[model samples]
Target: MIPLRLKIETDAIEPYVVRLRSFEGISDESHHTGALDAALESASAETAEFSGATGNLRLFGVDPSEVNGDVLFVVPSRGTAHRLIRANSRHNTLLVTERCDQLCLMCSQPPKKQHIDMFPFFETALLLSQKNSTIGISGGEPTLFKSELFDFFNRAMSRRPDIDFHVLTNAQHFDRADLPILRRLDLTRILWGVPVYSSDSDVHDRIVAKPGAYDQVRRSLSLLCEAGAKIELRTVLMKPNAPGLLDLAKFVTTALPFVDSWAIMQLENIGYARQNWDTLFFDSSTGFDIVGKALDFAISRGIDTKLYNFPLCTVPTDYRAFAPSTISDWKRAYVADCADCSLRNECGGFFEWHPKVHGYERFGVA
Candidate 1:
């Protein structure tokens, strides 16, 4: 048996077993806690042939068996920090709905339930809003259930007008109907965050898995801005869209001047991710190209820009400014790649799925 070395990411909430070798080894079937040694033993050996160098290895078993070694790691972000702060965070996510006209390739939740009564969600959000200055409402698509959507929005804002509510939408439905309620909501207080995968209509439509989605999103954005509603445009980078990434940001900077800001998120590894992993995900090494270009483009236009899920790559070498933001650290993909990184503390690390699929060991110096 090849003695397998195990690597673990510590950023995880619950400790997990890291097994780099195959399960076929050793003796006592019942006595063994699977392949993991209850107590980690220690050793050192060359890890990657590419580096032609050795890394210290910690063993967690009494038996000295030979097996493949695996590396596991974790890095926390603002989102993880916030979840840690609140005791009831387990009850705190806003699953606005399971309904959405566009089928984004990365839709975290599908059109599972379609519509939801705002009361159920509002009952919970109202309590959190008291303590949180900003409450972000994410969904199968928040705009789908307009009345219930605004119903909760109204209740929260009414109770604490000082609190800011943010709603993420595909921006498909809000435009066509000329409802007074949609316009009545104070744009000054609410933030309507929109998702645009690409600028090209054809690219955007296919990626969304819905035709004509580009037109609707385009029109809704125009209407939302015209009605004086605050706007935030977001883009999630993927393999297919990597090349034209900066163009999307360029379009928003030129056309949607009303958008309060722009944010570029690296694709996470989860849900529909594995099915599309070969095409949807990009490693952090390849990612710096896309991020560096987009950041420069948005900054040239004087728009506030950000990169979530990766601060190790995004931090400025000379000086920096900090803004509060929440991001998912891919527990499934986060890599221990940033080991010995200069900006590890400030960096949120990659999505778990990212490192799981791409391997954190490959992530290296620029």
Candidate 2:
């Protein structure tokens, strides 16, 4: 049986659905769209046997013990997005090396060019593992140490098979050596986070500081897709990549069919981003409109996407997100706008420095 993901439109509605699922064996459920009053309690000790629950779908209080025991594999909530996140609220990312092939302007970390060994890094990660483990092997580029990454995964998998893995790599590392690693790693438990700046290679390579980065991306993309590794194309949407937004969306939709999702992030005011904010960052003025258009295009293409840093109100209707609309829109800051905005209470708002760059006027009547 396939994993079932339930979708409930609103947070308010999630609870009631949870209540309804507590009953034994719900039959003839209504296939409805949109959010409702949602209630969720802790799972009951009395487990129900079921299977195949995933993706925008909730098991509500459905027990995983029930799931493992039964062949059915998943007892699904009628319509909720599958929350695939592991129950344990921890993630481990081992910095494989400081050495990066690229000089991305937005990198939060200082430049690391010398290749670092993996033995100590691997040991630390192993020590940090708890029951439900999700680990990301990050680096200037993890693939740079293709041999080390493969070896570490083999060791990690031997000890824990259920562990979910996220391999952060610049698609540039796809080569014969890398193939063996891809072959050895199980796809179900792994998510390859590959940074793809814009659909255009020129834009992507420019960010990576490697001129031929695009060629590597193209070849590796084919290999990653062929290997069936679940891939999430991490596209950092910035002022430079902004012009190619529509093209990027269409490119992903058309070219990277194997990609599981795309993370369209706004340039954060960190690392290279801080230095390049005037040139790279975008607030509501021109940035918001462009992002809204790109996002709309992505949705139209039936592409799965995520918006980070941007506030909620600034986003168009197509974007299904919980983030604030503008940098200045967040409540965390002691900014001037929050006092008058009706959304202040519910909104998570934006980063503290938002108002410093894109001030209150951008989010008018706030």
Off by over 4 Å in 1: 1-92, 114-121, 176-179, 311-325, 328-340, 355-366
Best by lDDT: 2
Writing each residue's lDDT as its tens digit, candidate 2 over 1-366 gives 123343233323222222122222433473222222122223445423221111222344455433221111112334343322222334335567777778887886657657647544354335334566776677767767777677777777877776788887887767655566677777788888888888787888887777988878878888888787898887777767888887888888888766887777766555677777777765544456676776777767877777766554555434535243433221235346566867666454555544365632345333
Query: What TM-score would candidate 1 get against the native?
Result: 0.67
- How does candidate 2 score on lDDT? 0.58
Error of 2 at 102 (Å): 0.8
Task: Return the TM-score for each candidate structure.
Answer: 0.67, 0.65
Worst 10 residues of 1 by lDDT: 78-87
lDDT of each: 0.57, 0.58
